[model samples]
Target chain A: MNELKELGEFGLIDLIKQDTINDHSSVVVGIGDDAAVLLPTPRQLQLLTTDMLVESVHFKLTTTTPWQLGYKAIAVNLSDIAAMGGVPRHAVVSLALPQSTPAEFVTNLYKGMKEICRAFGVNIVGGDTVSSPHGLVINVTVAGEVEPANLVCRSGARPGDVVAVTGNLGSSAAGLDLLTAGEWEDFDFAWPLVTAHLTPRPQVKLGPVLAAAGATSMDDISDGLASEAHEIAKASQVGIKLYAKQIPLAPELAEAAGQLNKQALDYALFGGEDFQLVFTMEPGNYEALLAAYLDLPVVKVGEVVDADEGVTLVDEDGQAQKLEARGFNHFRQEE
Target chain B: MNELKELGEFGLIDLIKQDTINDHSSVVVGIGDDAAVLLPTPRQLQLLTTDMLVESVHFKLTTTTPWQLGYKAIAVNLSDIAAMGGVPRHAVVSLALPQSTPAEFVTNLYKGMKEICRAFGVNIVGGDTVSSPHGLVINVTVAGEVEPANLVCRSGARPGDVVAVTGNLGSSAAGLDLLTAGEWEDFDFAWPLVTAHLTPRPQVKLGPVLAAAGATSMDDISDGLASEAHEIAKASQVGIKLYAKQIPLAPELAEAAGQLNKQALDYALFGGEDFQLVFTMEPGNYEALLAAYLDLPVVKVGEVVDADEGVTLVDEDGQAQKLEARGFNHFRQEE
Candidate 1:
């Protein structure tokens, strides 16, 4: 038997995708999208997205608090809705915990979830609670509503579309690196990256605006900038060309990456959990989209191309290399 | 800090429900019901329900196959929707599996899931896949749809409503007991009970009929008949009187219980995982409901009482005893 690590995350997704057959005609977009888009009613499309976070797999108790765990769990799932240009309306949270888990921890966890749900105008509807033998595991399913015309999906990209991103990347991975190394407080540059790693603000409000502004394709950068670009490319059957220098990096991330003897570009291109939106649009649509969301940092980093070109990244030195679709694979850690 | 075992299942739910303030008017029903009923559109209501199954906590891999695991995972969530008298439309499955899990195991798991989803006209839409360091954990979220008038909630039970149940009780628990006993092949009574424990067919068809016939309140017997009665009583602020004689038990379960030197009645009253719908309705509604689903087994087991009387159980000898709301509590097993 081959190891699941060899299959990689995308390979595993392909496996699940191959066998998945939709029985309901209501399902508009199924397995491969950021969220499953369903036409439950004629007037609007309903979005369904789910995420599971396991102890020591997605997060470690030593590195993150329960509040942050609960907060990030909800944020990441909502990010999928945001990526789809939808308004998140409700969430059901399921938690599996060991008996030793403190009651106060559970309360703080829900408090963190509630705080985030309140921000997005989403309600915490219901969930299941069960016991686990090892450590705490949290799974959140978020349901959102979007107008049919307003929905943006990964398959919408076309040749001549401008590849763009909202907010900076690399800072989150840098933050996680610092947290893993410990002594984060000893360095002044740690807080910004650490906060980015600990808690991410999902592109909730900006998603609909981008969709309304005629953004063609979009995805949340939970799996890194380069990896998400591959997703959009694969889904749309188009190629993407990204400029390395155009990849945004925060000053704190650069400083921390330098201090840690790693390239910030590595964090931007291959690191995970930024929770930013990487999208594509027609060149004519970029100006209005940029002008409308001036409050948030948005940048053009690439262009959509013919499928034969593949997903390629150009270095600052003008070296063009095909980017491998890699970010984080959980099974790899087992080895 | 008190260990979470002391909180009990209902107590923990109360804690979560206490602070779950709904932010949207779209959420018509929240934490207390089988599934959260949301007014996603004015024309119809949306149902969202989530359940998490931890390895060892929910099932023993030694006793159950990956196929059964996946099948039951989907079955339990759909049961919640059935308990709400809704039609399940789609599901998002999230699984956390250990690295050593076989690729074939994954394939069979999905095969089991797809088979069950097909039975109910439900679609497997999207999901999350990640690695678990411990044993496997499966979480499934099912979204269902029902007319606003067809929605049945735990809070709707009233005094004089006849308690109704679909399918016989205790067979599932009895099956589990036989499976755990580990010599099930030796007994003829074993197959029926063991099969009942492994593959529970949720009341997907009969639930809507019950609702249309005017069921006042409903719940699935995931937690045993007594506990479900306690749920309706607590939610509707009513009391319940269940007759021990009326509680249905299969002959196979009784024979198996006799061989194992355990009372089948205990399994019927106090055991769990039956996945049968236990509901209440006006006595006049019973005949119409029964006649409509003549092929399915539907019986009246009790009646809803005034709140002051509390949830009580009657013996075959005509003696009444207050029933304790005890079923399975995961945290309690930790000790």
Candidate 2:
């Protein structure tokens, strides 16, 4: 057996899928999408999503605390539920821990998770605990429910629906910059941004709210805006145009980007793990959505177009450039 | 900052649970049962189950092929769906692989899964792929659906309900013995048993059939007969009595156990990961249940009894001996 390094991440994933057996009848969609779908009963659907975060691969233990890791693990799955406009009911966490990890570190991690679950009313029901060969590996599975009428699939957008986002973008990416540069205190007051990057608060409340308000389609921003927009376009058989000028950038994020000689606007557009809700609405419902989120900005950055046009980003100067997805791909090499 | 080894698995699990928010309304039960329960939509019920198998913790890389691992990973989860009297519909697998693993090995694993999925008509829908810090970790979530009226739970058994098991028992454990002892020839013809241990075949077909035939309650025998019986007994608030003389043991298993001077009967009772369905049915349905599984032996093992009596196994001499749960507890060292 030659090393797995030779196969690369994408090759290994493709290989695994090739041998997978799916025998269940309730599995509406498996092994190929953002999540797995099953209609457990007539008129009721269940969505399950699981992700594994390993040390160094997904996070660095030296820089990331167990609490942040624990919170992020659950937050990511909750984001998946948010993407589907479903309410998360339960989560099972399986952890593989190193023998040397401190008990307090583990407890702190759970405390972070408890804080998040309390906000959203999600329960930690079951999980497995085993010793890891190396660092910690956390796999979280969240089960959520949706009525058929309220399910918001990524594929449901219309050509002319407006592309809007729940909150400001790029703050998380900017926070990562501060952490990487060892300047946590410089942006100490911006705890929400740092927490957004480390312990994302998924828009669980906003999902069903948007669905009730008649959003045409939706997804959570785990990947950058560019990547996620591409997904919606592909799924809905439409193209999307993102207005560069309309994307809001946090002031500190702008300063951080300037110091690094990078555009904060770019981060706002392409940085990932914001965990904010992004969805589309027709011209009619747009006003109510704006009214509902008046205190919190829901920026309308673009509009959906026919699929043949492809995705493009328009500058304030009216110059347009075609956008290709460049956000995180788990199978790709780490920076 | 005390080490994880001091806290142990249970302590760690409790720590993790304490940290979670656990507020989701869809979760009827979480964190402690064989599987979590979600409130079903009217006329339909959904069952979700997940299991993670680490390379060394669950299997020996040298002894278990990637193909067998893939098959078993999904099979075990399917067994959980079967336990709920649900028909499996889809599976999502999350895999963390070492950098050195071959793509071919991964592909072979999926090919084995494809074969099983084809046989059972399950769909591979979605999953995540990541680089492991060390050896491989495979986590699979299976989703299934059942009619609201037909779903069975561990808590539904009542006193006087007969305890029944599908097919023979202890073959898988016996086959594992052969694997450990390297007596290949003696088990050459017992591939079914070996496969039972290596690649579990969840009673997917029997799930709905048993539900339709009015199984009072059910659970899959993953943690051995005695342990699972104890679980059902505890949850149902009842006790159980087993007629040891009437317990069905595979012929090959009996011979192998006899050769090793081990009690084949005891192995059948306490060995784990059989993935067979152990259920209870009203005595009035016994004849119909027996006739329904005429092609496959459905052995009557015992009866649910009052909790005060506890669990007991009656010997051929008509003496009742107390049955202790000696099945697998992954957190505890293997005996």
Candidate 3:
């Protein structure tokens, strides 16, 4: 654990540069410059998204490694691009680290980010590194390209659209529960849940697939299904009706929820950081999309309704209840 | 002053969105979307840069207002775009703030950033806001476009190229001195220097002008003239010879330096945060560049030399000495 001060800003940057590999053809210049130069793809609109993760607020260093933290930082920003039905191409990461941080931690952090970038075919272009008086801060800005015809925005969902999601929900929250309880190792079923919490994969491919299948509005579930559905509903001036039973939850998540003495449905509806795609499409296109993704874990869990109807959830008893957008808020007091 | 927790994250974002005015036609989608959609300019290369500023490290709130901090945040990132000879089109600002901060401070901060964005014809596109346990961290990512033919890089300098800078040096450092001394009000002549430190303008227009005028290589002087010159030399694999007497200094800066019992040349050579452009151009193109920028303050301060000659500063006494890069490093211990 070499102190960050011993490496200096330039030294840390050099270590990062040595590990970075640029594979994108659009990257005319990458790293070691004041600014990165990228060639634009003809006939494609560019997508840009930025996300910041602060220590103690976004993550606890005591429970997570620097590597996991770095991966999550890039993954969250990439998820934003995924939600836009765009193909991520380049990223710039700005890190504010305390002097007491170890040089090895910084190196591993880059390694974690690089792993995801390589998997997604994104290039690490340029960024700034500065010292913080306390705690670690990471900000990642991702740039991607999207064909105008395939682009999906949250404002396009119409009444009578079918709402669907990719993969299982609530697992990330359940995993977090196991980690917080220190019972992750006690149950073999908790491994998947813990991994989901630590390194949740972004639905980057599912976005484009759904976009081509006529997804009218799409958003990644970073703030849980209900909250994300609320965003789409508000943006499109429509209402959302989610079927509680239709929502998918992994067995591991169910087991973990049971261990925590909580209902799995609650986590599925309100637990954030799922990194799954929640999309809305016309009912006519739902069958075709499902058929196209038959091998994938795509589930139709809801339908878009008129704005006057309001966002709601229908339980097994056929009772409709108004749904509150109870998602994560940085400044909100935790219950 | 209102507590940041009272406003919450979404409330703060709404405040920022209300103050933001988009003027760029390239921005098809700005804030409120998962990602910003930008129309790519035809046949142009894209430029991207990110900069992070942390509290108590990059600045102190005691001496500066939130408005100035916000303005400086955007300005610094814009400077990186300017250094690349690109026209800034969009900017994303990520802020990590403590909950104890005032809502009014956040509002004023956005106003400051909006002020600069409006002046530069750049749009505020997308960003993220997160809570920090302590202190403030601001990260800005700027995207711009540049013509491939007019793009300039630091690796293009040649041995016979002339080294020149736009405007005077050391004024920003002198202003910082005045600010630290708490005598900024007593010296009328120090006001300009103080303002320079507070809000150094990015030479956005001059970069393209110099690029068109055949600048071989260029970089903005953020880490003092000597350090920036070394970067160009190392990148281009050439030695640089700076004429100490020819380095431009503001009259106010000289007076401030004298009052601090420091040589004006020392301040001009080693003082950081100048926010000026240091460029290298062919000797033949220097006359045309000067003619083109006749109204602007452009000065020839040095010349590129053979690598064997090393980086040197020739004194007025006709003696040359090696120039060590003595710029500020965030992790380096102060001497």
Which candidate, 1 or 2, would have the higher lDDT against the true structure? 1
Best by TM-score: 3
Q: Per-candidate interface C-alpha RMSD?
A: 14.6, 13.8, 0.9
lDDT of 3 by residue, B110-197 (tens): 8889988888888889999988888999999999989998899889999999999998998888887777888568887888888888
TM-score, per-candidate, Cα-based: 0.87, 0.80, 0.98
TM-score of chain B for predicted candidate 1: 0.86
Instruction: Sort by lDDT, best first.
Output: 3, 1, 2
lDDT (10s digit) by residue, model 3, range A1-335? 67878877788888898645557678888998889999878999999999998887778887788888888888988888988988988999999988888899888899889999888888899999999888889999999999999899999999999999998999888888787888468789899887888888998877888888899999998888889989999999999999998999998877788789998988888888999999998888988776766597789999999999889999989898999999888887777
List DockQ, one per candidate, in order.
Answer: 0.19, 0.13, 0.86
Superposed model 3: Cα runs more than 4 Å off: none
Best by DockQ: 3
Better of 1 and 3 by lDDT: 3
DockQ of 2: 0.13
> Each model's C-alpha lDDT?
0.79, 0.72, 0.88
lDDT of model number 3: 0.88
Chain A TM-score for model 2, please? 0.84
What's the chain B TM-score of candidate 2? 0.84
TM-score of 1: 0.87
